[model samples]
Every structure is written in structure tokens, then in C-alpha cells.
Target: MPDGAPADTVTQLRRDLAAAYRLIAHFGMDDGIYTHISARLPDGPGGEKRFLLNPYGLRFDEVTAANLVTVDETGAVVDDPYGAGVNAAGFTIHSAVHMARHDAVCVLHTHTVAGVAVSSIKEGLLPLNQWSAQFFNRIAFHDYEGIALNLEERERIVADLGEKQVMLLRNHGTLLLGRSVAEAVKLALNLERSCKAQVAALGMGQTPIVLPDDVAEHTAGQYQKMYDKMEGAGGKDPEWDAFLRMLETAAPGYKG
Candidate 1:
């Protein structure tokens, strides 16, 4: 039942994967175990592609790596029972990205309150400040497609994603992709914060400091360069790590 991973090989990673679920809970993101966060495990020596996911129907706090489902790139449940259980619906979103982006090691999606708010904003993400500047010229929006269960939607999603790393599924949620777990984790959290900022700015009816088009492009390039330096080496972000620990304390049984 260990999915072919040596017994000890999967333990630490299971904890890390579980921590991701717990962190999602800490951030007030999770729709009764509906949304998801997933990571592509490097292919084993056998040449099969494997990934980790929170099993279906389990509340975010109830997730544990040991219970994480291991699946193939095609969204097939190649591995036996793991995680809480696999949701076939997850293939709607995560499978597309996993199959489309070979470098997309970790993909995080959310349906948080602010995230959905920004997704519906007609003006979209404005360059209100440096925190959002990275997204100024980089966010892509996909029009609402009721429930995204269509396999064909994968092509449309990938088309919308293009070279951008952050996306908003209109009337749905936000998505972030990165080649490493740390990078992907930070990207999603940052995207959520950006959306939260946009919602707050709009609520006050304040004139947001939208950078000129040229300025937005320049700033995005600068931020991209800064991240490029730290790239895969993007270490464990202390904030996310601490958040995971906090979840452990608040929901002590989550890492079970």
C-alpha cells in the first residue's frame, strides 16, 4: 500500500505535503476540502511520473501525507489508496497544469473570499504597489467556465497561462505555479495577498497608485530578475513554515 516508495522515502515528504494542507487552513483558504494544493514528485527510477495530493472529502485540517494520493501525469490514480482519497474532479484543474508544465513541480489553487473578489474585478489586478508590481503585467484571466470539468478546458487554461505564472479563474479562484514547492507556495500566498490588497484598495474608493504601462513592465522585469537569482534555491519561506507549525498547534490532529 506504500505506492512503491520505500517506506522511509515517503514519510518526510508526506509531512511536508500535509503541512501544505495545514498552511492552507491557517490562511483561511479551503472550501470544505474542495480546493487543492499538489506537488509533482520527481519520476522514480522506473520512469513513472508521480505526484502528491490531499485525498478527496477530507477537511484541510484532516489531511496527512500518509493519506496523500499518488497519481500519474494523466490524472490517473496509478498508486493505491493514499492520502484521504483522490478526487477525480481535481483533474479538471491540477491535471492540466501538471501535464502542461514539466517544470511545474508544485501547483496551488484556492477559492478564498478575497481571491474570488479580485477574480470578479473588471479592472483586474492594478499596480497599486511594489507588492503587486510583479503581477502588474503578468497575471492572466480566464473567463468563467462553469465547473471546469471538461478535459478540453485544459487547453484553454494552458493557453491562458502562456508565460505567466499567476492566473485568476474568473468567478472561481486563483492559481500559482512554480518549479519548486517553496516557489509555488510563495507564489500562491503572494497572489492571494495581492488580491486582498486590491479588494481593500477598492473598498476605500481610494485612487490606487496604478503605475504607467511602461513603468509596470519595468518593475515586473526587475522583480523577475530578483527571483531568478534565488530560483530553485528559493528556500523554505519562514512565514509559510511558521504558518504550518501554527496549524499544527491550532489543529493538532492535521498531520496525522
Candidate 2:
């Protein structure tokens, strides 16, 4: 298990992260071998920060627990049994959040057509539906500055993200963070659906109905309350458990 981290902890983290990759693929959110889902590992020896990321060129469905690569904050491969290094752009985007936000244990980024469509829109993610209302006033936006290979852009990414858990990489895609793999998956799924709905609504060529600011804020508060209750109840997220069960039947062997 990578020096300072407990064996059981790392094992579970690998399985969880692998499952996230498979789920993203199953939901059609994956963009071939691009984009990424990363989980911050427990600090290694000497307080070195590390993360588990899918190897570059591996489709999400192929990300087995045993195959995921471990990398340091500098994006260097620390433990890559398959000898598959990570994508440089993925590292730049994920590492920025991992370094800046201690609360973001799992960082998920996607390039769905609907997500990019919404990102391209001037209004961004409007509260056009109940699902979209959950993100009202909570999502951040980062202007695109070409591909994210340049290390210097990390500072701007962090600054734009600020303290928000969800972000729209304008004209690029969607990004979100969660305290765990399950939470990240949940947020990504919801955000994708919200974007899809917005695109469909706007395509009708009619003025879409948007919730009032107060109502939208209230709905967002309600969602937060539900999340807080789940956290208070020992973090036993039943929805995440159900998703795991679905994954077991639909796409097994991710835990391998």
C-alpha cells in the first residue's frame, strides 16, 4: 500500500475510483480516453500528496482497481504497475483542485455534448428544472485558455473555482468535486442531466421558464439540507449503495 497509507484504505479507494470510471462510462459521460476522475490518496511519507488517476489512453470501462496509477502533486507517476502514465492535461486540471481544496477528495471532469453546450451558453446553467435548481448560485465558471497542459493555468483554475463544488469550464466541459467517490459520481450524474435538460428546453425556440431567485435559492437550500442529513447519519448514502449494486450486475470486475 504506498508507504504511509493503510492497506485497507488504499484498497477501498482504488475500488471506489475504479467504480467511478466505469459508472461514468456506463452513463455515457466519458469522452474516449480524455477527461478524468481523480481521488486524493492519504498523504504519503513526508506529507507528500498523492492521487489515484486512470492511466492515459485507458477507456473508463477498462479502469480496474489494480490498474489505476498513483501520482504525486507534480503529476509524476509514483506507482504505475501497468506503466501507463497519466494524461498531462488531466493532471493539470485535477491537481489544481486537489491542491487548492482540501474538502474535494474526489474530482470529476467530463466532456459530454450537453455539458459543453450549456457551458457555451451565455446564461450557463439556469434553474429551468428541479435538477438544475440544486446548482443555482453554487456553480463556478472558468474561462477556457486552450488545452490545460500549461502548469501556469492551475492558479487561475483554482481562483475561478474558489470554494464552489461545481464548475463549468466555459466552452470546454463540466467539473465537480465531492468529499468521496460516491458523492462525486452523484454530482456528475445530476449535473449532466441538468445540462441535458437545459439544452432540450432551449432548443424548443421558446423563452424557457426560469425559477425566481428566491425560489431557486430555497430549492438549493433544501438539497443542501438533505445532503447534511446524510452526512449527519454517518455518511451511509443509500443512493451510492444502490449505484454500487447496479454496477455489480451491469459491469462487474472493476474491483479486480
Clashes in each model (backbone N, CA, C under 3 Å)? 5, 0
Shift in Å, residue 101, candidate 1: 0.6
Q: Please provide TM-scores, in order, for all candidate models, with all chains considered together.
A: 0.85, 0.96
Error of 1 at 63 (Å): 1.1
Q: Kindly list the per-residue Cα lDDT of model 1 for residues 115-177, writing each as its tens digit.
A: 899888787778887778878768888899899778889899999998777898998899988
Model 2 lDDT per residue over 130-239, tens place: 99999999999999999998999999999999999999999999999987888889889999999999999989999999999999999999988877676563767899
lDDT of 2 at 48: 91
lDDT of 1 at 49: 74
In terms of TM-score, the best-performing candidate is 2
Tell me which residue pairs clash in candidate 1.
Answer: 55-85, 56-85, 67-82, 67-83, 68-83
